[model samples]
Target: MSLSEEPIAPTPTTQQDAPSGFEETESVNTSMQEFHQLYQKLLVITLVLTGIIFISVWIFYSLNTALNYLIGACTGVVYLKMLAKDVEQLGAEKNRLSKNRFALFVGLIVLATQWHDLHVLPIFLGFLTYKATLLVYTVQTAFISDS
Candidate 1:
């Protein structure tokens, strides 16, 4: 066959040039819905555990308050684990939300210990770690958003 009889090459399209479609919007909406659901779940778990700790302290008054604080702290850890799982599933390239969640969790746990009049050095270290995480998250959010 002659060169003129050859099939023409398809034109290449740039990613920035692709037209927005229902698929893109739908996927974004689905991801946002998933994110909101996970956030609500984490909030509910934290609030419920906090309530349980309060009720246990008020009603029973049988256990050491440090132990009560520890129970709440452990529950907070489990809650973090749940959040981590969701973050992983979401495949988030940015971790602003996760870092804030962790920082708030650690701070609340420390305040709870203080409220119960407990002295646990290890918990302070955890707070420091959370603070570091918060710093990293802040930097990441700043740079990623600036792009």
Candidate 2:
């Protein structure tokens, strides 16, 4: 066929950069939502466990010790929330994870050390409650099947 007589095939449009399904962006949104939900669940678990443990500690140990633990637990909750926020913002607003979270730990330890009233062990253990919550979540997700 002659050049003028040949049928011209349509070219792909660059304007619509994404696929029709927008799977890439959609998956990101879905995963972010899942991460948010996971954060909420973990927060709830941490709070519930904190309350129970705080009460148990108060009953078994002493009110002062429990209060110390409470302080640490509160810090842990803040730290957890900050971590989630950083993770959510990762690669977007910020190129790397900020070291601000570590500052929270450092400040906690410093305060615990300086304050005669605050016992280092209890406060430190309380801060680790979040870690325990994470372990619980991992176990729940790994070992147990969704009902």
Give the candidate number with the greatest lDDT. Answer: 2
Model 1 stretches with alpha carbons more than 4 Å out: 1-20, 62-116, 121-147
Name the regions of candidate 2 deviating beyond 4 angstroms.
1-21
lDDT of 1 by residue, 26-97 (tens): 787898887677556555555554556545654665445535544545545555665666565554475444
TM-score of each: 0.37, 0.83
lDDT of 2 by residue, 68-128 (tens): 9999999999999999999999977989899899999999999999988999889999999
| Candidate 2 colliding pairs | none
Model 1 scores worst on lDDT over the 10 consecutive residues at 122-131
Error of 2 at 104 (Å): 0.8
